[model samples]
Target: MDRRDYLARLAGVAGVGLAGCVTLPGSRVTGDDLPSVRNATTSNTSSPRPDGRLPRRGEVTLPVSRREMRSPLTRDHIPAIVDPVFGDDWDGLSLPDDSRAESTTLPGDAPVIGLTDGDRARAYPLRILDWHEIVNDTFGGPIAVTYCVLCGSSVVVDRVVGGSTTTFGVSGYLWRSDLVLYDRATESLWSQLLATAINGPLTGTELTIRPSSLTTWGAWSAEHPETDVLLPPPQSNTIRGREATFDYFIPKYRRDSPSVIGFGTDSNGLHPRSLVLGVAHGDAARAYPFETIRREGVVDDDVGGLPVVVTVAPGNTLVAYERRVERQTLHFSADGPSRLSAGATRWQRSTGAGVSGPQATHDLTRANDHPPMFWLGWSGFYPETSVYGEDAN
Candidate 1:
C-alpha cells in the first residue's frame, strides 16, 4: 500500500487506534492488529559487514534484518553537532532568527539531559535535542550524548572505538522507531536504545554507558547552580536551515510520530507517550513507568539484580539510586515530595546523599544508566521487560 492508503487505514492520522499500548513480558508483536511492516533494502555502505550487506541508502541492513529497518530519511539528515559551545544561562539563549526558527526562550519546564562530574556540570536542553539527535563532545571524556525524538530516550556513552575515540552522526535509519547512529570513524550502524553496534566490524561490541539524568531545566538549575548549558545550533545560512520544536510532550501517537511507528496502542490503556525510567543491568531490563511513580512517589524494586529506588520529585523529575549503601540496603519511603528516608537518615533527593543521622556520611549510589523514556520506545526494545506495577511480570 502507498502512504495515503496505509495512513488512511491507521486511524487516518499518525497512529493505530488500539486501546492498550503494552505487551506482556516475553511477548513478541506478531498480532494481525499491528501495522504492516515496510520492506527495507538498504546496503551497509562506507564499510560493508564483510557478510554481504552494505549499509547505504536503500540497499540492505545487517543482523537486524531488512524487514524491520525503516528509512524515513537517509544518513545525516539531521546533522549531529560537533565542537559544541556552552553558556551559563540556559534561559538567556534564543533560537536563530528565522520565520521557521524557534522564537521563544528555553522553557523552564523543558527537559534537559546531562551529568555532573567532579567540578563540571552541564545540561543539554531537549528542544535542541529535538532538532539534533547526537552531540559528540569531549566532556569529562570522549562521549556521545544522544536523544531520540521518537523514543524519548537519552543515552550518554563513551565514543571510543578500538581504543580510539570518534564522533557519531544520524544515519536517518530507525530500528523500530529508535535512533540509529553511525560513527564517523567506521560508519557502522549503532542502535541508540540498545547501545550496541547492530552491524559492521564492531557489530557485537557494546558501548559503555555514562551516567546521566533527564529532568526539567528549573529543577536541574536549582540543584546545580554552576551548571553550563549547551548553546543552540547556529542558524544555517546555506542549504541547511535551523528549526525549532515548541514541545516534546507528544499529544497523540500518530504513525508519523516516533512513538507510534509500526506499533499499536489501546485507546483506554497507558498512552504510548507515557514516560518511564528505563533501567537495564547486563541482559535484564525493566521500566518504572511515571504513572506508577507519580501515584506511589517511591518505587523500591530490583532490576538486573541491583536494588533500585525510583522517586518522583518536583517538576515531575525522576531520580533512581542504588538503595544499598555500604552493603546495607535501606528501605526507603517518601519523606516529602522530593525527599526519601530510611529510619532517621534522610537522603537528599537531588544528589542521593545522606543528609542526617548516623550514616549521614554514607550515600546511596546514583544509577546513571537509567534514562527517562517513553513507553513505546522502551517496551519495543525490551519486550521481556517487567514493568514496576504490573502483576503479570
Candidate 2:
C-alpha cells in the first residue's frame, strides 16, 4: 500500500476519529522543487518587525555569508500562514516557583518537557506550550524551550549564540510540517527539527541542544517534587479553557496521526509512527524503539563507537547514558525500580550513579542531547539511522 493508504488503514484499525477538516494555506511543492526555489530571493523590502519597531531589512551584515539552503523539504513546501505570530516576549511567558505552582491543574498522564541544569529542574507542560510554542525562560541559565505540536518535536536550546544572547519567537512558518523559529536579534529563520538557521542573517549558525526529558507529568513530579511546573501565562483563561476541552494526548493521535510527513519508508522496517528515542554521537545515530525498550527494560548498545545504555524506568521514563566507568564499559540490565545492575554493580537510574560495586562512587555520563521523537521525524532527518531490533524483523 502507498503511504497515505497505509496510514488511513492504521488509523481505522486504531479507531481514530478525524476532526473537522481544515486545509492549511501553502504551496504543495516537494523536495524536487527545492533547487529552483533556492534561487528565488525573499523581498528585500522591510516588513514591520514583530516588536512594531522598523529595522532595515537585508541591511545588517550577517556574521556568515548566505549559502545554498540544504534541507529535505523545499522552501516552497514551507507554509507561510500555518502559525500565528505572537511576537517577542509574548504576554504569557511566566515561570512560577514551586510554592506558587501548586494551583495548576494537570492530569497525571499529561506530557511535559522535563529539563534539568545541575540541581535545578523544571517542567514545561504541553498544555502551555501548545498555546505558546516558544517559552523564553531561564533555568540556572538562559534557554529557549520549544514544542511543535504539528511534528511532535520538543527541543530545548541555549539562548546564547556566538557570545550574544538571542531570544526566539514563532516565525509563523513550517518546513516539512515542523516548527520554524525566528531569532529576534537578526530575524534569522531556524528549522526546529534540523536545529540550524536556514534564512536571513546567521544562516549557518546552529543552536546548542540541551538535555531534556519528555515524559508524563506524574513521572516528572515524582522524580523531582521540588521542580517548578510552568503555569499558563496569567489571564489566559480562554486559551486554557479551549485546551482543557481538547484531548491532544489520546493514544490514537500519538500513534496514528496523519500529520506525519516523510519522504520514504524508514530504512528500518518498524512502522512509521513508532515512537523512537534518537541518540546522536559524533557521526553515528541510532533509534531505540519504545516498544522494544518497554519490553526489555534495559538495553546496552553502542552508538558512534561509544558504549551506551538505554533505560526505561518506572512510569515509563526513558533515558540514555554512556555506560563507561574508569575507561571500562559496563553492561546493564534492569534490576528494580530506578535501578540497574551491571554484573555486581548496582546503579541508580535517575542519576546513573553507581550505588554498589567497585565503581560505587562513579557516575555514568548521560547522553543528554538524545531526544524522543516519532519515527517519521527521526528518520526524515537521519536516514542512515539503525533501528535496534531491525535485524530480528
Best by TM-score: 1
TM-score of candidate 2 relative to the true fold: 0.70
Displacement of residue 116 (Cα, Å) in model 1 is: 1.3
For model 2, what is the C-alpha lDDT against the true structure?
0.61
TM-score for each candidate, following the candidate numbering: 0.76, 0.70
lDDT of 1 by residue, 40-111 (tens): 453443355477564432122444654555544546656677767788764444533433435345567777
Candidate 2 residue-pair clash tally: 0
Candidate 1 stretches with Cα past 4 Å from truth are 1-62, 90-104, 235-268, 281-284
lDDT of 1 at 124: 87
Q: Candidate 1 lDDT (Cα, whole model)?
A: 0.67
The model with the greatest lDDT is: 1
